[model samples]
Each structure stands twice: as C-alpha cells, then as structure tokens.
Target: MREVKGFNMTQTINVVDAMCGAGKTSWAIQHINENIGQNRKLAFGDSGEPMKYIYVTPFLNEVERIRQATDIDFFEPEVKGTKIKSFKALITLGKSVATTHELFKKLDLDILDAIEEKGYTLIMDEVASVLEQYDISKSDIKLLIDNGTIEIGENDKVIWLDDDYKGKFSDMKILAESDNLILQNGIAMFWTMNTRAFEAFDEVYVLTYMFDGQTQCKYYEANDIKFKKYSVEKSGDHYELIDYDPTIEPRKETYEKLNIYVDDESNKKKSPLNSNYDSREKLTNQQRSSQLSSTWFRKTATPRDLKQLNNNLRNYFRQVQPTENEYIFWTTISDFAPTLKNPKCKWNKSNDRTSDNFVALNARATNSYGNCTSMAYVYNRFINPMERNFFREYGIEVDQDKLAVSDLIQFLFRGCIRNDEPMNCYIPAERMRSLLKDWSEFKI
Candidate 1:
C-alpha cells in the first residue's frame, strides 16, 4: 500500500474515484492499521495523543459491514483504540468511527469543536451519495443571510462572514458554501466513491479495476484553467457585450471511461456516448400516470399489507430449506428488498432500483433455482429429488400451484410494481451473500 500523505491542516479535502465493491473501506482500515503498526502518535491541542480516523458511509448497514471487515472488536467503550460509529456519535466518543453522511449533516458546534480540537482524518465512503443529498435551497440562502453567516453586498457580490474564508468565492452560493466549510478548520477529508461524484476538489485519486480484476490507484491534480470570456447578449432589442465569469457555471466534461473488459463489451452494445436519450424531455401522459400511481402506492401502503408480505416470506422459507444456489438467490432478495423499501434510498442517482420491481424480483427467484447448467447439476445430484420429496410431504403440487414470490417481495418491499423491464438485477452472488450477512440482524 502506498502512503497517502500531504493531507493535513493546510490541505483538507481529497477525493478518491473508485468503483463500488473496490475495497475502499479495506484500504482505509489498512492505512490506520499501518499507522498503529508504526507506533506513530498524533498531537491534539496541548496533549500529544494518537491521531484517529473516522470512516463515514452513506448507510447504517454499510457501517456494520465495514466494522466487521476490520476484524476488530470496536464496541468496547473503554478501549481507546479504533472503532466504528455512526456520524451522529462521532463527537461524543469512539476515537475512530464509521458513520453516514445523513448523520454528519446534523453535527453540532460541540462536535465540530471536538473534531477540530482533537485531530482526526475523515474517510467518506460513497461520496456521490452524500454530495447528491447536499442541496442549498433559496430558503437556506435566506436563513444564512439572516443569521449573518453570509451577506450579499449592494453590488450583489457574496461575502462569507466566517473567519476561515478562503480566497475561492463563487456567485453560486451552494458551491461557495460547500467550499467555505471544507477549506476551513484544518479538517482533512478523504473521499471515496464511483464516477458520479464529479465535484472538483484540491486533489483527486483515481482507482481503476484491471481486466484481471485487480485495482490500481493513481493520483492526479486538476489543472483545468479558468478564464473570463466576454459574450454578446440581446436584452429588450438592445445588443450588449456582457462580461461573464464562466467559472461560476458548472464545468461540462465527459467522465474518463475505464477499459475493464466487461465495461468495454457493455459499452460497445449501448454506449451513452453514441446514444441521444434526451433526459429533459417532457413526461408523456402514460409516464405521468404511472409515476402518480407509484407515488400513491408508496404513500398509501398499509402496515397490514407489509405484515402479510413478511408472514408469507417467513412461511415460504420455513417450508423450503434452500440449497446453496437457492440460498444465494434468497440472499439477493433479502439485500435488495430493504433498499427498495427504504424511501431514503438514493435509487435514482445510484441506479440500483430497476424499472420493474416485480420482474427484477422474479428474475432473482428464477436465478435462485439456478440457470440451465446448474439445474442439470441439481437433478444429477440428490437435491432435486429431496426438494420434490419435501413438496410432496407438505402436500404441495409443484405443477398445480404457481408461486408469486417475486410479486410479494416487490410489493411488500417497495409497495408498488411497474410494467417495465428488470434490467438491473445482475448482482453477483458473492456480493449478495455479504449484504445478506450484514442485514442478518436488521428488522423489516
């Protein structure tokens, strides 16, 4: 592992571009472990102490999984060593913690003070998810102005009242607001996420997965030039040459495509670069109606319906002890169901949710029975005979009865099903197993 340096009081934010399931948390853990191995102590205020690291994820389940992956007993309060914690609990205790972005936004002054006083490194996982959640509305700007945190001059130039104001300012208050906080307080942040996280920062590290399934990390500094350009504009039939700062406008660029074999093949088939899918098109009547129906179902799903669905699943599982392949299928269902159920899930940006929740659910169920090749193995072995025997014992006719397992799972989980293709149900079985294991203790 290469040593990640230059992150200190001066340089605060560093973004890492890595694919999902690319061992980002593992890399963070290894870095911390290396520090411990080297016996390096960090200073906090007047006291010379060991510096701590905080890993922040986007979800609670991610926190648990990351904690487990560390193979460290983190729950013991007395242990001054590293531990995983939610972003909400970072200020209170736990020297080294793992938390979500949702919890981090609610940080109080006391917590911020503690963080500043006691030196710590923040490793933000799934940064794109966090960034998507950060939206500065007009109301927020008004409140900030009222509170004197920010002030607009008579000339309309924005001024930050905070003591830690950096030279970088923007007409767009949201960018300025984010920059002001991150650049101040000597808080070093390490961000890791997929390509969707496109915010320009101090430094960026790109992690690429090779054709052989190995990951390589490369560091690059953004040297994109910013210069002012004058343009002519007509206002009320009067032509005027207007001087505009294009820096305030968002930079438009295509993401660098990685040359992973699978990605290359997929791109060849349906490249977004070659496609002309206009996302800004007005919604059709059918789409509008479908969206309304979905919204209605999501809002009006009763507790009784949810309870019934859960009962059905429990009963089904009780009747059939799944084979290894079937268990893998069940694992995917368990992992996906919760995410679909979660209203807070960033499904749109992440593109994790499929258009047809029902078809996706059925695809998973059918895949559990295994593909043709695996089905041949099941029949050749004693598993198929045993399953048939069990069905007979339960007085269930295999051909006579149709199981709407997918429909039940989808409706129970997401509260609605759409008439569309299940294109996004291709999760690897190993990843599904890990997710299922993490969600073992999770209720609902």
Candidate 2:
C-alpha cells in the first residue's frame, strides 16, 4: 500500500451521483465483473495476485444481489460470535466480499491493519450514515465528566479515559475506542465515521443521488477527502459510467407522475393542513421547525389538530385516493406513527416486517418499498439541528434547505415512481411539497 498520506486525492475517490433508479448498482456490478476478468488475465504477472474487492450496501438483499450476479465467490461475513471477527477474517484472507452497511460500520480499528495489507477496491452501494445524533441524555454527559471517566478536548472531542470500564456505558467505550465519537458544544454527542477507514483502498466508489446534499459529502469535505463525480448512463442495452452531467436528468417523466395533495374546502380537512410551513427559506428556525415536523406531531399539535390530521391520513388512504390494496407506504415519528396511522390501511404483505409499510421518514438505500404506489409523507423533512451545528463547529458550510429537498427526493423515490410508474403521494406539508415541486422542475 502507498503511504496513507501519499495517495493521490483524485485517484482514490470516485462518486457515482446518478439520479435514483438510474442503475448505479448495475454499473457497479459490471465494473466488478470486468475488474475480475482483467485480474485473472494478469495472474501470470510478477505480483500474480488478483485485487480484492469489498462491496458494502444498506441492505442484505442487495449484498446477495451482487454476490449472486458474479461467478466469483463473495463471502458474507458469518458471525462465529461477533461481526468484527468475521469481517476481519474475510479481509485477512484477501477475499472479494460483500456485506451490509451496518456490519461495515461496526468494523473496528484492528480491521484497518487487515485492509492495509492489500489493494482492495471499495464500492459503497449508498453513502453510509457517517454522522448521527447520538442518543445520550444531558445528565449522562455531566455524570461521565464529573466521574473522571471521560475528557473533552477542543471541538468537544470526547476522549474516553476509562478504557477498562464496562457496564452502562460499554457502548460509549466501544465507540471511543474506534476514535469517532464527538461532543458538540459539550451537550450533543455524535458518532462520526473514522475517515481513515478508506485510506488503504486502491479506490473508493460511492453510489447515490444528490451526493452534494448528503451528510456523508459534508463529512468528507470536513476530513479533506477529495472525490470526483460520475454518473450511471445507459448508452443502449447496458448501463455504464460517465462524467456526471448536471444538465442531463434521465426519466423526468416519472417525477411528473407525482400528485401532491392540496387541501381546501373540498377536502376532508376544512383548512389546508400544515400550510403555514411554506416559504421555508424566509421562516425563522423555530418557526420553520414547529411546522409539520416530528416534534410538532408529538408535542406542538393540539388534540383537535391531531384528530384532524389523523382524519386526513385516513381520508387519503380510504377516500381521497383509495388504494388498490398495493402496499401503502407512510411515515412519521415512530411514537406517533400509530396514532396517525390510517385505520385498516396498513398493508401486511409480509409477517416478518414489524411495520410492514411504515418506512422511516428519513429512510434510503432500499428497494423494498418500490411496489408502494400510495405514499404518505406525514412528517415534514428537516435537517437535524445537530447536523447543522456539527458542520458549523468545523467551519464547514452546508445548505440545510438544499439537503432537505435532497432527502425528500431519495425517500419519495422508494415508491412505485422508482419503477417509472405513477404514484399518488399525500404530502400535505406545503413546504415539503413546494420543495419537491421546485426540485422536480429543475429549479433547484
């Protein structure tokens, strides 16, 4: 491996920012197959070694897809006990493997040594969740500091002084050991991706849409990791990689198929629901936050408002645009999802799923909901305030509103529209609706 600091920035990074449903995965499959064939031809060369590959995606089904497509043996890390041991075994054996993003993120500092041993190309099916709002109460943070179990440095970087510690905060000890935990303003804790994880790869490819609007993109910028942009393009029968053209938007017709709900006297609700949320750029942060947000559904909305919103949800599924019993995809905060769930509209096609059609409001990188034609974006999208604050603390600027729209498009694309079919969406939040409209029309 080259000196970690000596790798050429451009040579190491390639981002395939194709529009959703543009076959980014297809292109990746083709790239891997070709690389394998080329490697085999050079088996007689001086090194006589085939380069290894590590493919990580958001779902297990996708891992299976790549593993099944090629003739090469792709190992799905089996837990003899823990995932870290299984994954390190695959890398240490120098095998081309496929795995889920969750397991990929669970990898520890020791795995880096195994990765650095060879030239492995890394293909990330979707940008991993590199930053998250760590759920630790303020009381816990204060207690840890007071007990001499932790120390805080500049940028509120949390250092775990208690390595041998195990118990209530064993999870904290594990994260600190990985060297990615951070405390924002000594209040909010976040688990950041250890950027050094990608250092040993010959090259890295991240496939997704609106890459600029993703938190991973900002995280990469903050880490000074430079990447080049590419997109999946269909030349004729097959998909291939090409320089990403912002002007070239494939399948715009599918976006035209969305029918956003607009409430009036004719609708079940006497007034427009969450209509005060429009002109989001002009609203104060607090004002913008309270409208159609998860917090609003949980705390801000009055009983009367909740009843009306619940009725509106039912109206959309039962009356406004009654389903043909196609899997109905809807989303809101998990706690309030039950109250707002339309009666008898929850489609249970599979017994395995806990919430058959209740996809998380911020979900992405899955095709499980592609069959869903009737989708309800019950909650408005908002950039987590901590997300914005984290970037700000690093003096890195991010466009929150742009990221909001980017998220909406990725989530909405999970519906039948992803299959290029018409979808009737119930997005009563005017601000989210407008954002979708503006983005669809290429005004973004």
Candidate 3:
C-alpha cells in the first residue's frame, strides 16, 4: 500500500485487463479486498451508511463462484435460524441492523438496468469475446452504422475484422482502422496471432514451445524494454504457448480498502421474540403500542417529536373534518338520537339545497374539530384520501381510534420535513386557505 491520499474521485469503471493466465480475476479480487478493507475506517455514520461489496455478476454461477472464492455465501435464507447469507438475509440485515442497509434486488428491473449503466467495476471475463459476441447479434447491435465504420458515439467509432487474414492489405486496414479511431479518440480491439495487430498494442509478448526443454515467454514494449522471459510447460503430447503482455495489473489499491464479507450459511432457529409481523392488524397494534409509549404522546414533549406529532395531527385535521354531507350527518344524528343527554349521530342526506338549515349547519361545521374555521373541511377531504392511498401503497393498516391529529399530521407532512432535519414542524397560516377552498366545495 503506497502512502497515497486516495483516489479522491470515485471510479465509475476499473478495468483489469490480461490475457489467459495473467491472473486477472485473482488480481481483481485482491484489489477489491484491499480497497474495501481500507474504506472501513472512513465509513462512519452518514445519511447512507457504507456497505460491504454488493457483488453483482451476470449469472448465478458466477455469483456462486465469487461467493465461494471469497468465502462468502450469498444465497442463504434470512430466518433467524439460517447461518448463510442469502438474498433474504441481506435484506433482513438492512432492516434490523444499524450498520447495514440494503442489497440490490435483481428482481428490480430498474436496478438491473442501472447495474449495466452506472456500475463501478464491471468485472468482465473474456471481455473482448463478450463484446464480439454482442456485436454479432444484429438485434442487440447498434441500430445504426455509418459508412464502413460503426459510430459508437457522436465522435467515436468501433472497427472489427476477420482474425485469420494476413496481408499488407489487412495490415493497412488495421493501421487505418486504428489510426482512424485513434484520430477520433475511440477504442479498438484485434484478434490474437496477428502480429500486425502489434502496431496498435502498447506492449507485446513472444511465446515459444520446446521439446525436452523449457518454454520461453517474454514481455516487451515497442520502443522501451525489448523482452522479459516466462516459462510454459505441457501436460499432453501437443503443446501451445499463449502469451500476452503489458501484464494488466488489477485496480489493487482502490479495491484493497473494499472488504466484502461472505459468511458461511446460517441455520439458526426462529424465536418468539423475533417473530415476523404477521398481518396488517398486528402491525397496527404494534404501531399503536409503540406510539403510546413514545414521548410524542406526552403532554410535555420534545420539540422535534412533538412538532412532528402536531404536524401529523394537523394533516389529519386538514383531511378528515366534516363537509356538508358530514354536517348533515352530524345534525341528523344529533336530532335523530334516541336520548337527549347523549345524542348519537345520523348521516342520511339526499343533497337537497332548498332549506337553508342544512346549509347553515354545513357552514358552522368548519369549527367542529379545532379552533381554525377550515380545520374540519381539511380533515374530511384531504386526510381520508391520503391515508387510504398510503395504506394501499405500503400495505400498512391504520387504527383510527389510536391515531391522533398530531400523529396523522406528522405522517402526512413527513416528506416535507425530511430534508428539513433538526428543525421542528411549523404549520403555515396559509394552509387554512386551502382548507377553506375544501370547505366551499362541500356547500349543499
């Protein structure tokens, strides 16, 4: 590890290039371990906590291979009894532990697309072959090609040719193609065995086969060092030596700080204390108890939670108070009650506007739930729809009796106050205007 300050800028892609036996995968793994492990010291509390490597490969086989090589299992069940780190386990870790967050879900198609786009290290194997295969699939290939060159971007091009060809013409094609792309500042690739391709490569290698003797391998640069030797041995009667050079080094220092942990499968037993949330009804009960014990429910509360609770309450007030139908319901119930001491309510109405009694009742109903004139109107129209939608979207169940105006206000205005952390919830006076508009709509 050099005394480097660190690569202050984030790397979008780190390419570890090497042909066959250059140990690219091993080098890449070493790099990842070093960088991630180093990063552990720097990763402290923040909005988004640091996670161990979220290894993403193309297929399950590669995923499993990486997991085994790293001594990490990525496919264990998340139940308490499970010892392995499964996809389910990773998510559970995010939910329960403070240090962890989330693992990307492959099921999330959006994330899959993002992985292909803005990913850090693609960790591609046989990358040139992959690219070649991709180019051959016309359906997957670029929808457009410009002249003899396929324009990769507004200014870049990709050039390809047959591997077996060996003539001055092909050599000229390689030079022209390389120079043309280089002129446009583009990337290019050429097949092996064509030493004419050496014109385009930064480094070169020489491979030799031997009988009853050692094989010779040398790496060299065109203008700098000529060659350095490496050995090759054979298992069968026929032997071939494949050499590639400039010996692509892994992005070691960067990934050394990155420590990805792969644990053996866990097989723990589930316990009563950590039972899963069974149903929406159970979750509601849990939430109610949690809120009831929290300081927000107290008369003298901390400014933050109290403010949030009040804001939640205000939201409920804005969403659920009475309209004309409700006022009519209230009056009808009050009038139609069986007893005078405790008058129950009736809400039956036919939308008749002739008599002004119902109109007066509707008008006066604005002050039913709070001091503000429009509180009642805001409560009925706005809060109801929002609550229903939120529950439907998140699969949460609400208990109306246990719910308070402040709690509801906090819930409704949470998104507004999210970025405004360390601040108390403060309702604006102008909200009453919207409430009034809601009230006017309910006039019968």
Candidate 4:
C-alpha cells in the first residue's frame, strides 16, 4: 500500500470493478486495513476527532452479512489490535458511523452532523445499485406524478406514491442535497461493484479472475504514473495482493466485451436503410394511420386496408353536415379500436365512454410498442419478475395481485413513450414513425 497521506484527499474516490464472487468486499477490507496501518492512524474529522471506517451497502441483508463476517474475524486475538467497529455500535457510542446507502438517505440530522464534523471513509458496496437509486432527476418525479404512479400532497410534497417510486424519489432527493456536504468534509469514498458508477473519479481498480482462477488487479490513477498491476489471493474470507509492479503487462484479451447500447444520439448510429428517414416529417392521414398500426404489430396493414381506413377517417372528419349520431360512432371507433380492438357499441353499458384513462392507456400502448423493438433485450435486462417471484416462492406476505399487475404494466412501459395526450385528441404521428423505424432497424 502507498502512504495513507498520499492517497487521502478531499475528492479521494476508488472503484473496485469485479465480477460476482470475486471477493471484492474482502479485498476492500484488506486494503482499508493496510492503509490505516501505513498511516499509523485512522481518518479524523474537522473536529480533530478520530473518525470511524464506514461500510455502506445497498441492502440490509448485505449489511448483516458483512457484520457477521467482521464479528467473527475481529474477535480473534491475533486481529484484536484492529480497532474496527460496526456502524450500529459506533452510533450507540456517539462516534462516527457507517450504514447502508438506503439508510444513509434517512439519516437523522444528528448523525449527519457527526459525519460533517468528522471525516471518514465510506465503503459503498453494490455501487451500481446505489448509483441507480440515487440518480434521481426532477423529470423522473414529474413523469411519475403525471402518469398517476405517484401523487403529490397539499404541501407540494410527495406523500403518496408506489412503493418503488416513493423510495427511489426520496433517496434521490436526499442524496442530491447531502452529497456536497459529505464530500466537502473530506471523506474518502470506496466503491465496490461490477460497473463504473460515476463519470469522474480519482482512481479505479479492476479485479479480474484469470482462466487459472488467479485474481489480477489493475490500478489506474490520475497522475503521470497511469497504471500498476498486482496479483491477489484469497485467504478464507479476506484477500491479499502482491506489491504493485509497474513492469507487469496486462493479460491480453482477458476482458469481456459488454454489448451495451447507450441511449444517446451519437450512439444511435444511422442504419443504411434509415439514413434518409426524418423523425420530424409530417405524414398524410394515410401515412400516419399506417405508421401507428405498424407500431402495434408487424403486418397489421396490407396496402389496401390502410388506404381504406385512411379514407374513412378523412371522410369522417370532413362530415360537417353529418348527424350527431354518425359523428359519435365514427370518432369513437377511430380512437378506441387501436387500443381495445373493440368498438363502443350502444348495447355495451360496461364500456367507458370518457377519455379519462385514454392518455394512460395510450402511454402504456406506446411503451409496449417500443419494447417490441427488442423484446428479448427488454425482458432479460429491464424486467424484475424474479425479484417479485422470490417473495411468492418463500411464502412471504405481499399483495401478489397488485404486484402482478404493476409488474406487467412496468414491463409494458419499459423504454415506452410517456406522452400524456390521448390518442382520441391527437395521434402521435412523429412518435409512431420513429417507433416504426426502430422496429424495422431492430428486425434488420
């Protein structure tokens, strides 16, 4: 380990990128211990008081796991000299503390005050999840509220929302407000996860297990000495690595290629067939109807059928002298058929005539259309059915019916449009064309 003073800085950050079961947590503990030993002292706060080492994880289960492991190791007489303590114990003793990233959002003022007064190292486990939970934006809040997934209160505050929606929004708000305070206190942050969680950071260490089951570490720093290499070994639940060697070359082709697509214009490279396609071009009634139907299902319109429907819609709109009965019949079928595939007949009293749920349903339909672009990609990567199923498998109490509906709706909406306008009010001509293009390109 390098000198602690050399590594400790106001913006000191480190990311431990490794695969599951790669002993990242074990490696982090060992690294912290070595740094503490090298400094011959632990980190202190602005109050000049000794600060505690904090380990933050995404879940309570992880906190319990680390607590159990640390309790067993620290009690050994050989390791008794290490003055390690859990966040809970630290809080009870009125000392600096550690906690899960979720709990960090709900931390009381007193605990936060202590953290601001005393600098500490924050070891964040499952860094990817933490980043996702905390990366909240005002736009996300507005979307949830507008889509009826959440509701604001009289105080202009989010008082009632879906479980996941409420939690994510609250945590994002807290983290956004408090992160600067925590950082300004000169705390060091260590992140352990599979993916890079931040755009800017002080350093990053990648841990890879070779084919022979040996773990290799590659360190990247900001200054002139750009990289260093080391070999790591696991002893029980802890890890140890060889001294940094600048001469070591990275193993050739040892890294896995991730086929991740970014949702940015630059990354949305033009396909040869779509090179001339314009997202903003206005389409005729026939072209618009065909584009909208194309989003619903492939081969939805033969050229003949599309031309007939387009003509009917145009004639219905042109009927200024038509009876009220004829006007209602045509308009209702034109708007409702694409969504429910059933006409609003006079005999059906159960059918909703108002456009109360139209916007929401249209938003859902649009989302479903978008997801069909890459069904496999959306299903495996975006859906969380397994998480919900885990409760049922274990006989845990939950609103299974609600969960099922919510899950289905969420899956349908994944990567979908959130336009609040009802299909009856106006067809999203441009959006439909864009979705058609996306589906076409994906098929290609």
Candidate 5:
C-alpha cells in the first residue's frame, strides 16, 4: 500500500493496473485502510458514516490479496470501520435497487442471464483444478462444489444461482454459453480463463517479474491504459515486490472449496409459464363503411374523432360551462389586475372601506374568465416553483413544467428526476430555500 505521490486526484472513476504479482491489490488494501483509519475514532473505530469503496477484480482469488492484507474476513469483516466490498457485492446492491425501482431491469436481466448461462463450466473447471491440486476426491469435489458455496466465476460473468440451473436443459445452456471443457487441465487453463474474465473488468493492474528475483509494478487505468514495467522495490507492508518469488508459492489450498454450478445441459426456449400457446384464437371483421359511419365512429373514436371531441368540449366551455369564478381566482392570485389595493389606505377594518359585492364583481370583470387562465395561475404560481427544484435536483438544464404531470410523475418515480426517489424529498423551491437559508449551517 505504498502511496504514490500526487495520486489522490479524485476523479469520479479511475483505473489501476499492474501485472500479476505487482502491488495492485496491495495498493488497494492500503488505500482503503488509510481512508478508513483517517476517518476512525479511538477504541471501537467508528468512521461515523460508511465510506463507499468498491474493489472489483476477476476471480475470488484476487479478493484474497486485499482480504488478507486488510485482515478482514471473506465478505464479512469483524473489525469494521470502512466497508470493503467486491464488485459483485456492489452489483448486487445496484440490482436489488433496480428490481425494487425498475431502473436497471434490462441491464440486470442481460448480465444475470449471461452469467447464469456460462458461470457453471468455469466454476467446475476451477473447482476441479483446486481439488486435483489439493489431492481431493471427485466425490469430495462434487460435495464441496454443491455445498460449501464458493463463487468461482470471472468478473462480468453472470453469477449462477442454485435454482436457475437445475434439471436437464440448464447444462445445455451452460455449454452453449461457455466453450467445450475438459477436466485434465490444471491452474494454467483456469488462469487463462480468469485473465480473459479480468480483461472485461473496468480496471486492472499489471506487474512484471525480473531475473534478479525482483518484481516491477506499473499502474494501468484499464485495458486501454498503457501497460508499463517498473524496477522500484517498495509496494506496501505485505510482500516486497522486488523480492517476490512466484516459484515460492504465494499460498496453497488443501480441502476443496464448495462451489455452485448450473445443473442442466440442454437449451430449451421456455415460454411464459401460464400462457397457453396452443389455445385457439379468433379475429372478427366488420364492414369498413359501417365502422366509419356516425354511430360506429361514436362507439370507437379514433384520433381524428378524439380531436373533434376535444374541440366540442372547448366549444361547450365557450358557450355554457366556462365559470367566471376561475377568472376571479386567477386574477386575485396572479395580482395581474389593476384593482389591487394599497395596503396603507385600503385597510378593510377602516371606517372608509366598504364591504361591496359590486366592487368584487367589477374586479372580477376587469380580467378575462375561463379555466385556462386559472390553470395557468395554478401552474405558474404553484407548480413552477416545485418544478424548478425538480430541475435543479435532476441536473436538467431546461424548465420541465411544460411537461405533462403524468410525464413528470413517471420521471420522478423512475429516478430520472433525481437519483433518490422524488416522492421522498420533493419540495417547493421557495419553502426549501427558506429552510435551507434558516438552517445557517447547511451546505448543498
């Protein structure tokens, strides 16, 4: 975890790269540890708020470097301050939110299906290699693969769940998704598969081993980031990269790890569970002329018919239903009319003032009457302020109150309006601004 000078430029995202046996894992562990330690208090080591840091790498074995370095349990740390999470855990969190919110449904389905389809063979191969290396029996390997529950697939590979891969067709889909597999290959094949998997990752670290028994490390942001070698010795507290000997064996496993794999091997395009595909269906045809006639058209109004209907509605309002009260309300609320009184001279409680209906009617008559004016007032005075806050929160550059309420409602609920659900924090701008100002210490 040697801190590189001037490396703390916090971009919203970054990539770190080094070759295998380089100090990428070491750097990650140290960065996380320092961040946690800086934020911690004495004794129980409370960091106040959980710092979100996600370390994504290919293979669960890569997880070991950081896990061992940080002295934390696999996926569960007893000594807690900062949360150290794998990319899979982060994806799961996002997936859970997506399910509840429907925000990431398509992405989740695509990724999940891909992993479920291919994750099995990879797991089986890895487990077989681990078992053979550790002198475990085939039955013992099977038991461990079935029961102990180790995640063995590469990153970005769809994760396999026990239920999704059961029965005959499952193994077929798995074979389709993965290459043909043979069990005799050892760690080398698994390593190659892992390398391919790791390449899919958003970031990677590359390292080089030298003839003098020293290793060099360089950071690559991603696969796109140029890979470079280093001759420097220091990495962090664990193993010295310059002194590292890959032949010395970093670690070895004895008992086979329990892992999960898909069960079936056939590809079956299953349809919706409750739908009856063989059921008879019928369509009825009626006369086109009759359908276009007055009675038929009235019964089944098309867009043209709907437009006529709306025009008829507006005409009805013009003739009969347009209420004068809306005009009065709009004018009064908008303060758009000339009848507004000077507060000092026209105090209602004064003797010179008159309680006059004539004055009120005259005031109402001073402006036009209709629902449109009242609706405009409702939108401009009431809705627009709330909408401005909405626009600010959403990072939208344009005013969106021109959008229909149903559209806005969908946006709010779908998280397009804000990353957090709009229902939880929607506020009128004036009120929110006042509260924010009054708080004095609030920022953003």
Candidate 6:
C-alpha cells in the first residue's frame, strides 16, 4: 500500500482492491472521465498532451463494456491485418484503446518503442495470468543444455546460447529472447509477463477483488514493484475510492441466503449410500480429501460413489429446492464436467457451454451468470504441487489454502449471489464445504 485512496496521480501501480459487487468498474470509468477532463497536468511524465489510456480486460465482452460506458473514442485491434499492427498504429497515434489481456501479454520492445513517448495509462479489469508453467519434459530440457543449445543462468534463468538454433525449440527461443521464460529447479519452465510493460505506461490501475491471494500479487513483489491499494464504494448514485480493507465480507443477509448444502444423516437418506460399502468404515481427513477431487472423480471413485454424487445433484435441483425459468450453474474440472453432469433436468445446466450447464472451476472476473439461481461447485480445489514448488524456488511461499478459497469465492460470485440474490450451492467435498463456510464467516 503506497497512499490512502483519493484522486492522486503519484502512484504508478494502483490496485482498486474491492469486493465482487462493489462497483469497481464504475469507479474506473469515472476516474477515466475525470482524467480526460483534467488531462492530469501534474501527473508523472505529462507533456501537456491529452492523457491516453489502454483499458485491458480478461474477456472481449468486457472490452465492449468499457467501450459502451466511456465517453472517449476507443480503438480495438482491427481484423484487417495483424492485431498487433493495429495496436501499434494506435500507440503511434496516442489514442485511448481497449483490448484483451492476451494482446497485453504480447507487448514487446516494438510496442514499447511506440508507447515510450505517448504517456498512456493502463486500466486492467482483472489480474492477467502473470505466471504459468511451461510444459516441457526434463529430458528435453537436458538435451537443450547438454547439446550447447541453451545454458541455465543464475536462479535457473534459461538463456539461449545457440544463436543459430532454429529447430524444434524455435518458439521457446523466441520467448527466452524476450525474457518471458523462467526455469524452476532446472526442470520446469514458466511464462511470466514482462514487467517492462508497466514501465512503458504512465501509470497502471488494476481493478480486481482479493488481489492479495492472486499469483500476480506475488509476481509484483518478486520484481520489487510497489503498488497502492484502494477500494470502490458507492456513496449515492456514484462510486468513490476508499482505503482497501481485506476483511470485507458479505452481509449477514447474504450469509443467510446462501445455502451450502450440508451433509447430514437426513440429507444422506435422500440420496442413499449404497450398502456395497461398509457403513461403519470411518474415513480419515486424508482419505476424505480425495472426495470430490479430480483424483476421486477421474480415477479412484467407485460407481456407487459417483451415482450418489449425481443423485445428490439431482436431489437438490429436482427434489429439495426447485426453481422456475431461471438458469442454473455448476462447476468441476472441464474433463470431469461430463462425468458429474445431470442430464435429467434442463434447468440444471446453463446454456452455450459444453452443450449442457457446466461451468469451469477456475471461472472468474465476469458477470455473465447473474441470472443463474443455483450452482454446484463439485471439485475440491488445490494448487498444483509443482507450481507451488516453482514459486518456492524464488523464495516466495505460496498460500495454497487461501488460493483455493479465493478460487471458490471468485467462482461463486459469478452466480446470482453476487447481486445479493438468494441461491443454492452444493459442494460434495467436505473440505470445500468447510472452506466455503470459513469464508462466509470470515474465518479464513
């Protein structure tokens, strides 16, 4: 945190760290309008030209939202030629533009050349995928190093020593040349967004919820970039910036409204546990961890266990709590969506996805499912152990539990509950249920 929330121009990296329904996007639009009016005369690197902005969001639909709400003329990456070419032309013209995060990641030295003098501000609608593991086998990496094709530098930085290397690793060579590829433990490869992109901008505003629990936050700290924190609050008909508070939880009414289908003796009777398995067998916390996880859904689960899960899903939507005409949503890993999907009821599935009502477990930063009345988040979320080890190699200890809770929170907000509407949620995994409960009570 750099400064208290206000209309300040000094901070280069600003995080509007607000909750899901706190109207963060509205505040950003207002801030843009104010900057357009004032032209940020006292802002850093200002040369009396009008302030230029590049609003980047996670989805193309959000790009349209910014274009529709803002008063300024917004240029998108055109389809005439390469999108990068159109974006480069926009940078040369010093115009405020809107695009997706994918294009923002592709910003190279070429774009930096055009943008260095433009003094453009960046408004990111959500945290972009700042760090991701690059899938390559350890032996393949060994071949690259053993053959004098590449060299591992300090801190496992993969350096392309072979200038004439235009073979199978050409794509890796390009990324390595641009300083985006990172090696972990001399085996795993990772792709991180270049921090130089932020240096090219006059200032940056990242509008998102739970920024601390995200990987991008850790990425910034590792690079020694300092950022200020603010929160969006509605005063009357308008929104304003307030000091960030991490403890902001949903209202008590909201807690009462959301029903995380509890598993009890009575509920188990509705979807009976098959007698094939011994009822007296007690599961340890370790054994129970597999329940509703990818391991259980894909491999270890017995037919009776899956039947009970499917039956439980049907019991909630059809037997226990029924709704009319409204959309329903549920999430699991993409691979297990079909395995757990309820094909009996139409409303149990949301439209235009997987030809059924299946949402992804990692879904976030969108308002496309506001009308969905019910959602079943079936997977027991966990961070990849290899990815966690990658961060640890850089002296950054990842919070696996917080990240899991954060993922569930982001996915839950995608439903009608975000607008303070009552909704039904079912989590078959006991760990996920406890995590959700802890979050609702501000326990974690």
lDDT of 5 by residue, 1-444 (tens): 112222322311122222223344455455455555233222366435323332333234344444566632324221244232222343444321101101111122234343332221110000111000123345643443466322234322222345445554364234324422112221111110111222222222332222111111111121122333322234356533333333332111100110101112265532221111112233134322222222333344355543433343233224333423222121112121122222111223232323311122112101111111111011111223322332233243331222222121212222211122111111112222222232222121
**Model 6 lDDT at residue 413:** 86
Q: Name the candidate that leads on lDDT.
A: 2
Clashes of each: 1, 0, 52, 3, 20, 2
Q: Kindly report which residue stretches of model 2 are placed more than 4 angstroms away from their true locations once superposed.
A: 1-12, 39-47, 263-290, 344-355
lDDT score for candidate 5 against the true structure: 0.26
TM-score per candidate, chains pooled? 0.33, 0.89, 0.21, 0.31, 0.21, 0.87
Please identify which of the two predictions, 1 or 5, would achieve the higher TM-score against the true structure: 1
List the global CA lDDT of all models.
0.31, 0.76, 0.27, 0.33, 0.26, 0.74
Model 4: weakest 10-residue lDDT segment is 373-382
Q: Among these predicted structures, which one has the highest TM-score?
A: 2
Q: How well is each residue in 129-217 modelled by candidate 6, as lDDT tens digits?
A: 88788878999999998999888775566789989887878889977887678787777898777776776676889988777778888
User: Residues 1-28, candidate 4, lDDT per residue (tens digit)?
Assistant: 1111132234433434332333566786
TM-score for predicted model 5 compared with the true structure: 0.21
On lDDT, the stronger of 3 and 5 is: 3
Q: Best to worst by TM-score, what's the order?
A: 2, 6, 1, 4, 5, 3
Name the 10 consecutive residues with the lowest summed lDDT in model 5.
123-132
How well is each residue in 1-444 modelled by candidate 1, as lDDT tens digits?
Answer: 111222233332343322222233445556556555232233333234454655655556666776776644333212234322343254456356666555554443345546655555565653222212123455655766687767654323345676554433333333334332211111121121211122212222221111011111111111111212233333563433344322221111100111111122544653221111113246555432222122222543345433433343333224322212222122223233443332211123344433212223322101112221110000000112322332333343332111121122222122111212111121211222222222222210
A best-first ranking of the candidates according to their lDDT comes to 2, 6, 4, 1, 3, 5
The lDDT, on a scale of 0 to 1, for candidate 2 is 0.76
Q: After superposition, how far is residue 183 of candidate 1 from its true place, in Å?
A: 18
Cα lDDT, model 4, residue 230: 48
lDDT of 2 at 416: 84
Off by over 4 Å in 1: 1-9, 12-16, 37-48, 71-94, 128-444
